[model samples]
Target: MIKRIIRNTGLLCLLFLTIAVSQTSAQESSNLKEGKVSYITGENIYVRFASTDQIENGDTLFIRDENGLAPALLVDNKSSISCLCSKLGEHTFKLDDIVFGRTVKPVSEVVQLQQELPEKDVNEQVLITQEPTKESSRTQDINGRLSMSSYSNFSDEADNIHRFRYTLSAKASNLSGSKISAETYVSFTHKLNQWDVVQENLNNALKVYSLALKYDINESATVWAGRKINPRIANVGAIDGLQFEYKFKNMFAGIVGGSRPDYQDYGYNFDLFEYGAYVGQSKKTENGFVQSSLAFFEQRNTGNVDRRFIYMQHTNSAIKNLTLFSSLELDLYKLENDKPTNTVSLTSLYFSARYRFSKRLSVFGSYDNRKNVIYYETFRNYADEILQQASRQGVRARINYRPVNGFIVGASAGTRFRAEDPRPTKTLSGFATWTKVPTLNASLSITANLMQTSYLDGQVYGARLSKDLVSGKLYTMLHYRWVDFQYVNTLTNLQQHIGELDLSWQFSKKLYLSANYEATFQEQQLFNRLYLNLRIKF
Candidate 1:
């Protein structure tokens, strides 16, 4: 397996080199903007950019890995110059790592009335922004970022640990202003004293998330070869073979054929072959836009059908002050007691919507029902339920109000339940932020959360202060949180205090550095972690 991985990597590198040599002067200019990862907590990652002018919630962000410009982050919330994002897959990221977001959408009147659409419509929306240009196709336009970082952990009960990581991301779109384009993202990581682990299995320390080449046949059609995730068929994951698409007016269609990556190590696995086709339409109304897509897919293991399914996605914001999006997947093939069966089963469903009543007030809600996707020929031994009920079905709602300039408040509630579970899980959270504190000249935010589950009941309170020490060049933040919980089943209580400090510095247009430290104090023990990073962009 290692030999095959190395051979495949070499072949891809050769192909990329050949293309690079042939298209030295074919690049064109781009409007892509750079952002750096600043903080990661729970499932959210925060990024600081020059400005959020053209960036929107639900937009996709790219990162560098061994493969190429793979989709890594999904923008969930944004302020003037910062965004809150969530990981798209299993990819891990570090502070000061660079991310790219293109300036595509123009501010529309509908934006004042409703929130943005979901990720399912992100690709089509970006495509709509790529109108044909009159400039020469051979002008060079290139952008990318590279970085290195280290992480350290100290604990009272365990030995100290350290790790280092390096990442590279680049993109040459419309290379030399021609029809050719290339993208790649790659990363490598290793422990402070574990060189042998990397020497024995390089895949353990290296990851290639994306690498692909693209060519535009015309303004209405395009083709991509190599490993890439098609924006239109993103739910299908990355395709390692070929993808072709054609657009007619506002309607589009595409086909993809590829092999799934190795399930264990994320390496090449041609034996896990798959293919699918999708069709969708996008239309811009005077106020907003609407898009919808449908797809059919099948996968095979060793030439035998392993799974088949249908995927559907839709988003609409044509109505003023209202936006809606939904995605669904239905399994079409199943196996029972070693017998082949063809039955339609609902595997996943998600629907969300948001409405802005006015500039100061808005509300959002969502529902989710998901089950484990089955791959017949791949995992016959893992045929039972392993996922928790809380992840399978849930509902949530939130409301935000900006009563005055620089002052914003929001509250949210969520619940999860199933027929087989005795108690329903519930959570309530609220936050208030003052963009500018009168005496401190800094922003302050306070938050609290109350949560109850079958096993525990908890309440958390937190406060944070952030400031720019040297305007655009330096910044700092301080945070503290207290957690208190009681185990309902065990009748025990627990409490802890956590504190954090973050600092960032921009030395020049292409250089940046950041440091972060955190400590957790409990009644019996204390834990501390430190991270430092240096990044360069071109």
Candidate 2:
């Protein structure tokens, strides 16, 4: 398995090298349009229309395809340059110059500015070319998958569980003119029993929907709007909101609704939460891309209880054998809850960055700070909180090195920062995952945390690892995790461990079945599961 991963990675590296070595235009365009780019803001580029009378009001701007022919967007007197410049770049921008969009366009007419006036009104389409450009496509595709697992122990009837998940989506686009699109997703999961008289369990659900339209107002920019997904990411790739994103130039701004699975309320409410907004930007340099974002959140019912934050991410590796990605975020909360239990308003800031020394080696570090609003008392979820002690600042980093192609070695030690309490708890975590192509997948992950909070319930240390073996039509997976809790002020001592394993068989590409077993070290036990997967795109 390790050898396969190595070989595959090598092939991918070679592919990237080939792509990096070749000029993007040469690789993607048959013939190039010898025009200049203007209004360079962040990652966006707008071509200024020149020397053409028909090129008025964001018009007369067309792009050349493989055939060496260009499409044009004639200008109109009513064109608003500001509105045009506002929709210039993004993953889902008005143009198809990049591969981020599921939809494609051919005319390449984005309206950013109008130097002249055309006979046609601003909303009227002008024909700058006798024939349409040779390069054009129309189609939009959306796809994704979801999975859930549960562990059960039938022996002591101690560890029992139940869970489920699902996802669905669709899209459509037109390349010749403005495009319209829509998509939605839903998911749910829950544990089965409370292990008779031992435990308690619950289930939850999540749903998402987004719609949008993009119109090239001219040759320089596109205007797009709709309820689309927002990119309010934090914690690397660990968090995001499936809401709206309003993008423009080197920046985009918009809102989103609830997003979740934040475990400890550390994340935006994922429930049928209120709306939020996010803006972002990316740029091209001699080396790589630079990305940044700002996000704001509101309650689903609209009152107050807002969680807003601005984050910046810089990515560059234009160098050799190295890549860098870092992020900084400040979270502001406007708590409106009148309940006294609701502590002070708070602001949390965090920063993290990682450097890849090589495909197999990299290191990362993170830091965070939190402060309460008004009286300056620490934001506490409960009494007996660490007041000044809750104001913690710490740094944790680790290095991952892979000497051989298949096996990787990683070690790390650091303190985990908690947002609510704003405290740094001692922690050490490490994980390694290896996938052997023909049939096996294995990973070992461990997390150790020693609470830094002041109360009796502050200490918690846990670790988890899982392994899966596969052969032909059958596969088996095993997972285990343990936690130890302790506190200085009180005897809130508890140690627990849970383990589970499951087997699955794929009868064919469209059919599959699976079962699982789960067990806890003591108290509760339960067996869980069955699964089915089907592919139907038509």
Candidate 3:
């Protein structure tokens, strides 16, 4: 199976390369669009622009640093005037930071627009694009990263386990001045002595996360084939067939028809077919923007309806210094006692908001409620108890305040509970950080956490210090944490001390190496873990 999948992937890759190399166009034009970081949540970075009409998913955004532009963010999702991106490499971004996007446009159009617009507006947000000579070549912008990592674990209670992982992610947009673009991310992982397992299921060792070819039908319509995830309806996961999207000014619509990956091993599964459609609208307000999407989907197993659901998402940031987002999913089909019925049930809901009170203070809060999603044909044997207890719902809130130039403190509290569940989980954590010490010139942070669950009560205390060894080239950090736990039923006490050391080096603009070592010491046992990774980007 691995060989077959690899052969297919290789052929597709070759075809893409051939097409990219053979295509040629007249003199190319370039325009720079500047945007600002507006909001960030976990891995999602939101940037606001005058418009994202020319931006596409997987495009790279560059950091507007004094030294020059460097690759910074990968566009993951976008609305009319905003983009949802993920950070690249180890770059750090904060609110209001400037970023730039390079776009292909006609030089005459840019010139005419600049002449029509006022001087102040053009100077503040846009840059003039000079016409290229007749001999100028089209830009085949490409971004890619290849990395390998090793993870090793050793403990006195069990045999050591070691695993290695290799991953490659690349995106080639507007290939060779053509409308054709391709994006893929693939990974291979295996354990040191797991040949038998790999032989049994090659899919387990090799996984093709995404491989898709996209064609821009026009300025407002586009189509994609192969395996790709539609960020507008991300909850649907990867679709293995075809996707079509069309935009009309601030309103847009999309349709997806495909088979879901195999439920067991995430491999291709033609038996599980699905289809969905979604519609959305985005508008830029005076202060920020508002976007909303609604989608309906139905999945089938061997031509039988396996599941049906509706997904809704909304984001509003029109209020200055505030942002709000929410999503909801409702199951429309269910099976009970061998009988199929259509009954609407809420399956998942999430809402979050953040407000920046001032330059030195901000607060964030979120609520999430998720229940076990049932598929009639997929998991028909699941027990009632198993479904009833499979709920994880929680609420969390945090506040951060910077008292001085280098000193900052923050705290967060969270709780999880369900209607029928007897025990609840609660957590409280706080941290104080000194970004720069007067004499040592190193960053230091102290943290404390308390957690209470049905099984045990625990407390953790930790501190970390980090410094740059060679300015922008090398860095290191040292951290120590102490943990104490008390069993609820056994009334037994346990304590552990953990120490970690981390080192990272940037050999060049595109090459990086990092290593981490951690050790945990208990009364009668010792555990050690080591991780190493090397990455190169082009």
Candidate of highest lDDT? 1
Q: TM-score of predicted model 2?
A: 0.48
Q: Kindly list the per-residue Cα lDDT of model 3 for residues 107-185, writing each as its tens digit.
A: 6543332112111110011111122233423356666567888888889888998988887766666776787777777
Question: Can you write out model 2's per-residue Cα lDDT over 131-212, one digit (the tens) per residue?
Answer: 2233544343322223333322234343433333443333323432334332323333333643332222112233323223
User: How many clashes show up in model 2?
Assistant: 46
Candidate 1's displacement at residue 400, Å, is 1.1
Among all candidates shown, the one with the greatest TM-score: 1
Per-residue lDDT for 51-131 in model 1, tens only?
677887657677543323445676655666666665443234555667878675346522432333332222222222233
Counting clashing residue pairs in each candidate, in order, gives 30, 46, 0
The CA root-mean-square deviation of candidate 3, after full C-alpha superposition on the true structure, stands at 10.6
Provide the global lDDT of candidate 3 against the true structure: 0.66
RMSD of each: 6.4, 19.6, 10.6
Model 1 per-residue lDDT at 265: 60
What ordering of candidates by lDDT runs from best to worst?
1, 3, 2
Please list the residue runs of candidate 1 whose C-alpha ends up more than 4 Å from where it truly belongs after superposition. 1-138, 371-393, 419-422, 491-493
Q: What are the lDDT figures for the candidates, one per model?
A: 0.68, 0.35, 0.66
